[model samples]
Target: MTKIPRGTIAIEEAVLNPDGISWMAESATLFNTGADPKKASSHGHTPQLLDIHESRLAKMDAHSVEYMLLSLTSPGAQGEPNREKARKLAADANDWLAAEVAKNPARFGAFAAVSMHNAEDAVFEAQRAVKQLGMFGIMLNDYQVVGEGGDAEGKKYYDAAEFDPFWKAVEELGVPVYLHPRYPQTKDLERGTRYGDRKQILGAAVQFHLDLSMHIYAICSSGVFDRYPGVQVVCGHLGEGIPFNLWRADHWYNKPVKKATRPSKEDYSYYFTHNVSITTSGNFNTAGLKFCIDQIGAERCLYSIDYPYDTIEEAQDWWKGVDLPADQKEAIGRGNAIKLFKLPLEL
Candidate 1:
């Protein structure tokens, strides 16, 4: 392994609970609150920061990560039942993030939050975040749950025709749309769960990748990729299981179904090559990273820490020793993110 530079960029470092203790209460669950009977007491507040500033610098230094692109945590605007409330929270979160980045422009940047309940609001916020706040892109928490109608049984996806406006805005602004995963709806959440409550959170850690991967497939098969060719979509955790099973996914497309409207060349691999990007977050396996780079190409892979859950030190310790070409490692660590987000490379 080649020596990584002293201060490389880790684009996927997250900034959760911007309102601090208040925001934590809103998103906290029993399992993640460190109240579970299974874990040790020392696991309390795994990524505790004295405050936001201390947290930011500490993790950055620990990982030798010079730049971090902050994002709102899981169940961000996606959990809001009311569109109006969701929109407000989205704006407030973006504003807070922008201000935080502004304090240390070189060291920090952010992905804007959006309320996917309303397509119009999602578009508006995307434009505002990029044009005004100078956000790198938009971070959406998996599928948006709007009323009782927006669950998995409802089959409501953001890539549908009705959500074209959101895609249009993203493409127009020339910013990437990161598809971050949330826990799946109740019906589809059983596969990865082991026990009861423990299963929910643990299942999330594992299954979110699968959920987002399926969403990517749905979008592509539904012709969303063909329609919005200019827009770039990124997924965390090594394309969220897509690369590992891509061959199988493509095999499914080969079996003749009914009349397929999309072009013959518009296969799963086409979307993988043309539209998608991946990040190495909690996944630290060297072989997996190398395999992903081989399958998807190094240009589409980015480095991330999945901070708060996976620490910067652990991530760096693993990443710094991964066996790959020097150029590929550098690209995964920083170059790809810079090119993808059009981030300023002053430093």
Candidate 2:
């Protein structure tokens, strides 16, 4: 196995039970629970499997992954309708994650789960996760699905003024926020499925990333970064299409366009430089990774496998051999993660 630079960490690796209600599985089941028995079967297994130390250690050994920053599976605490249930679930998930990380401190760190529905609870959990549990950061599934009329059509967003308390607490805590993707809104379902069955899957992957990316962009453009300059936000799957079309996004910003938000000379790319980062989980394409590096710089990239949806061996095999300058490779493989997460240097 190839050796990466010392202190390399995969910041976006998932840790969840197989039976957990993952956003991907739940969204797919939206059509018919019976249509896909596989969905129901895999629901609770994600966290259990992700928390298994032996399996994760074996995977790390096989892949030469020195450290993995673990997060609760998607929609774990985010999908709950009751705010109190959401809070309890977040606490339960964080407790589980903390214990799992304690099992192998040298090889693991955690991203705490928080219920965003109640901003106060979200802040309290954030503090507990970082200050007490020693988690590296917090993982927020795209948007807080609060009620029935919260989609794009309804234009309800977590970044709205109502959620400032949550954002303020995040800033105060001084930990990064890993914004993971979730399914698209119901209003946009048809647009996502126009291609085929594959389109729905592929499009959802594409759309979820874009949705999260745009939300972050909105938060940034809305002066969130300016207010809380020290706060860091991370996205997975190579920044969810932002790197691929950054130039187009910038060009459009320059052109005349209707703007609900005030136009600023600063482009979206500017914000990424100061406050954003991304990981390579579930996106193993070398060409795309290289492109992302070129667009965002290696300092902003981290390596991840998106396990158990993806195998560590496969991601490691591809990443360990990708063609890039040694400095760039080291940064993407581990240096960036170490610096971003403030991980201990043990490798």
Candidate 3:
């Protein structure tokens, strides 16, 4: 087995605030037909999610993770229905996360949570989070679920033209927006038709990536990356399975008819490989890791634990046992994230 490297970084690790603790529970109701508020709030990972100090650090130390980039557990500010309230929650969560990172800057960094309810507000909060709060990156919890009660207008994906300013702000701030997955019950009819009985497949099992990749692919196909080529986007769970299937999609898009209708200037793979970086967050299979490296290269892959949701030790152990070259491993474990995020750390 390979030994642990020093100062390895884990992006996509989750943290929460006491005031905003109920957001996850509320999210389950919005997106999970089977969500029990009690069970969702009191899930086994609750302690880890709220901890910013000793316990989390101990886990990192034991598992050889030198630092973590934390964000609010999903479906965060993005899932909130009330637009004004969502904006406030985003500001509050980012502020709290900043304070947490201040407690131990060496062992922790954080991503800013922004409400996608209104593109204007999202732009404002994202700028403040990066400039004032000192967050390393921004997090958007998939598509923003907009509207109140059953009147929801459905998801507002960032790929829309109105969000060009938000993308511009991120590019100017020079921070990657970590697009994380959320539960898939965004629509009752869709949930009932497909993932209805099998609740297990709806969350992280299958639906999370299935739903998220649509939005990611939307951004790839929507000319956002082409418009703002400086903007970088990070996705977890092995590019939400994009790396595995990207070649086929890119192959199909070569059709003159398809190309004529599409908005992007380059192939899907072009935006994907150039603008996107994926992390080894929850999907810890060594073969999957190798396959992803073959598709996207190790420089675009970052090592991450997806902490609290997935055990830290398991992810670390998987990395230790991966059959990859040492330099590649070094890049994935530390160098890539260090350079991409411009992390101020020494390994």
Q: Which candidate is the best by TM-score?
A: 3
> Model 2 residue 95 lDDT?
87
Model 2 worst lDDT run, 10 consecutive residues:
195-204
**Which ranges in model 2 have alpha carbons more than 4 Å from their true place?**
1-8, 17-39, 44-51, 148-156, 184-199, 202-204, 255-265
Estimate the lDDT of model 3: 0.84
Which regions in candidate 3 have their CA more than 4 angstroms from the true location? 1-5, 27-41, 185-191
lDDT of 2 by residue, 1-347 (tens): 34433534677777664335454355545433245656363443445455558877776876677888888877667766567877888898888889878977877889999988767888899999899999989998877655554352323356577777877887888789998876545554454454233343443355566567778777766767766678888888888878887888777765556344553446778777788888888888899988888888888888887876677788888887899998888888877777777777632
lDDT at residue 6 of model 2 (Cα atoms): 51
As for TM-score, the candidate ahead, 2 or 3, is: 3
**Deviation in Å, model 3, residue 189 alpha carbon:** 6.9
Deviation from native of the Cα of residue 270 in model 2, angstroms: 0.4
Q: After superposition, how far is residue 326 of candidate 2 from its true place, in Å?
A: 1.2
Among all candidates shown, the one with the greatest lDDT: 3
Say which prediction, candidate 1 or candidate 3, comes out ahead on TM-score: 3
Report the number of clashing residue pairs per model: 0, 16, 0
Tens digits of lDDT, candidate 3, 1-347: 43434857899899888876665555544344466756665445566788979888887888788889999998888778789889888888888889988988877888999998777999899889989989889989898878876655577988999999999888899999999998753454354566655665667768889989999999999999878899999999999999999889898886899899899988878877799999989999888888888887788899998888788889888888888898998899998998898888764
